[model samples]
Target: MGRNVRKRRSPLAVRAIAASAALAIGGGGLVWANFYASAHEENSSPNTTKAATAQVATISCPDVGQKLTNVPNKARGEVDGELATLDQQITAAYQRLATTRDAQTRDASFVQNAILGPLKNNRSVIIDRIKLEISRVGGNAPSSLDGLSSCTGTPASQTNAGWGNNGQNNGGQNNGGTASPAPSPSASASAGGQQGGGQQTGNGGQAGNGPLAADFVDITKVQANVPRKARTRAGGSTGTFTTSCGVNANKKFNTDNVIVAPGVSNGAHHLHDYVGNQSNDAFANNDTFAAAKTTCANQGDKSTYYWPVVRIQNGTQDFDQNNDGGGKEGNVGQIQQVKQAQIKFVGSAKSQVVAMPKFLRIITGDAKTTTNGLANANAHWSCTGFENKVQLTQQYPICPRGSTVVRTFAFQSCWDGVNIDSANHRTHVAFADAQGNCGNGFKAIPQLTMRLVYGFRAPTLQNGQIKNAYAVDGFPEQLHKAATDHDDFINVFDDNLMNKMVNCINKGQRCK
Candidate 1:
């Protein structure tokens, strides 16, 4: 393996570290450094200071949506609108925080007084509106929601710590008792951008938000961590159903999320690559989906499949760069087209699968996992050739020359057998347990698994500078962490096609 021995950090990384140190000293003492040292004592690399630090990076707010599980259907629309407002509030505050680094360095309390204080007040009012909406519809609103109004600054280290380092120490250098050499500058240049010269500034990449150098790991050094599973039982749904949906080659893109924030444009706060249904948007309804044409080869299936668009931050600007969910919100780059997208439905290991109800909505992974913690985080990033050997949940893999980046998602496979949708947009479907058994009252449904491959040059990290940095579009406050990567699906399969899929799986036959 080639190695780049340059020890100099990038200008942006240097400035971030200096600003963080100044903020730490001006705000209180050396608390930020001490905290980061203690937290990452096991794998403290030379680039530790460049990682997401607490003092200067991004804002952290409580995820209110995750706490609202029982919102009444009658009030769900209003509540979702309020929730989107809350997100907007956080995004605005984060932008302020990013632009006021100098102020934070001068006065530690500037963030608290000028930014977080006003943000808390704004969120409190929004939370109150949500509470009133729920109560007006005869639902019990949780008083504890008031506690979620307050926001805090998150250390970059804490945000990056969502996924532990798979027992490899010092940035995967100690794996197999061999120190993995950094990618050579020439090799890094081949990935995209000029080596070490054309990289973006700020803590992250072009948009200046995130996906820090610490957010990537050398895939070759990772050990095979996928666990072995038992064989399917005698009555297991052993078959598979494949749907050929063209990768968004036509560039169906939007920032709307009809399931979570209906009737609201830019609800997702990030651009999404869409396939399947052609009429999917914030204003789309069940009727709209049913009547929509599909990109899938199967005309009977109009299911909508979408996920956050990945961008190459090599100083390129997309059309949305000037729009709300685009550059104005810190997502700036050229959106990379997905090279391949494989949508497959498979049977459960324990029993024959049942058909998913029409309009059944399912979201795999959490778009706000940075601040929401890992309760619903399900991101799995890997390189094409090394997928079976290793999978990453929090870190983006730095693939070798022959490999490309891959994102895999195994959506929830069990349904409640009642509502096609839920208040929080998650309760209607649940993931099967380790034994492939659904919880009581839930029935087995064909699990949707997506494998999306991007053939862009793999990004390289050298001296704390990420060259040709690429990140998934996400809420501004979420900072484009790999853990925040997510996918959305809404089943619109016709009755006949749905039955065909069920039969194909239950009968242990693979069909397209």
Candidate 2:
């Protein structure tokens, strides 16, 4: 099994998601506006006037549209149905956005967003037009059932007398010879301007003016309605791994933990959260992993432990390597390639190594094996200036501070007995056996994910254990030179638990 890593976004990426979400809401409003304009235009025409009369020909039609529910009812269902359909269209737009990461593959998504954003947001625009027409219908009704109010030829019953209001007398005072009297405020709000086959005054606000009462859609509610469309982003924090344990001949852990600056420095940290806050931190990389091997071995368990690495396939978001090109965004395919390389490094492992939740040991194709596919040589050791060497630190009663001293590591030093850098040389540096040189700096950080799970003891035997451990000397050089194979590995962790981990990171708990 593999651990799920939340991808982090650059500030620009965060803005992009916000912008997209805003557009989704805006799209819905536009649809409603279009409908309102069309309705108003139709009402102005002679044919529409007749149709409007037919629609309300019967005074017996119950005044059914009351109380605002998200759903539409029979009396108002036709217009409401159109709004519902518009909601569907907006939902579809979000779905497309979740699936696509870049602008080019998202034509349908863009179209949907652009179309629906304004309509759903402009409900007031709709109400205004409807109110204008409602004013024509008058507010009060006759006490007796009327034949003209019913959609069917028969007269409506007393129960629906409210629908029979002819508005001739009970309606407001007729403005000096105007065709119809103005509607009352309550009537304008509820009935929306339909009385006596006449047009009504504007509702809520003037035409083509003012904001809608329901402009802000409940985003959380929308999320519930469409769970699959939720966005997943990466954590912004970087991880640091600084064990100097003579593993890999005094080289730091072979993993690469990219520090995003201004983040915590626990070594080899992986990004975990993406949607809400875009942040990152560091984690311990080399401690408990090798220790788990020894601890399990002494207990006669054959399980092996290692760290997990990942390549985040950030679906349409752009990428910037070293923040180059002033934050230029790349396409989805290019981002996928970066993610694939990370996966390849994390999933490769020895036969008996069962991947731990957050940690995993990997075996690359370029790894040399003596026989039966055991790790012959690791990529970490080959990158030294000279040949390659691997060495484990002396068994430690306690994990040391800062980088591990090679003398205390479990593996022998892989150093080739040559100092690569005289300025920053240290006694604990391990030399490569093949190249006779100390490992370069790349291997200094342990695998970021594994560092997260260090010291995590399995609660049961069903979970795998670490049997043996090794650190290669020349990681960066050897890692790239080795053959590469890609695996579509499915790795996941419980989101709830992962969330706890995220919280821990935020609170400065490197690995809990």
Top-scoring candidate (lDDT)? 1
Q: Model 1, 1-512: lDDT tens per residue?
A: 11111222333543343343232211000011111111222222221213322333345566678778888778888787777555555555555555555556667677667656665666666778889999998999977787876656655334434334432221121111111233232222212112122322234455546656656788887777765543689889999999998999878998888877776667787999999999998878788888899999999989999999998877668898788788887677888998999999999889989999888889888887656655676768888988776777767888999999999988888899998888788888887776777886899999999999999987776665566778899887666777778899999999999999999999999999
- Root mean square deviation (Cα) for candidate 2: 32.2
TM-score of each candidate? 0.83, 0.15
The models' CA-based lDDT, in order, is: 0.69, 0.20
lDDT at position 323, candidate 1: 87
Q: Summing lDDT over every window of 10 consecutive residues in candidate 2, give the lowest-scoring window.
A: 480-489
Model 1: per-residue Cα lDDT at residue 76: 82
Cα-based lDDT at residue 508, candidate 2: 30
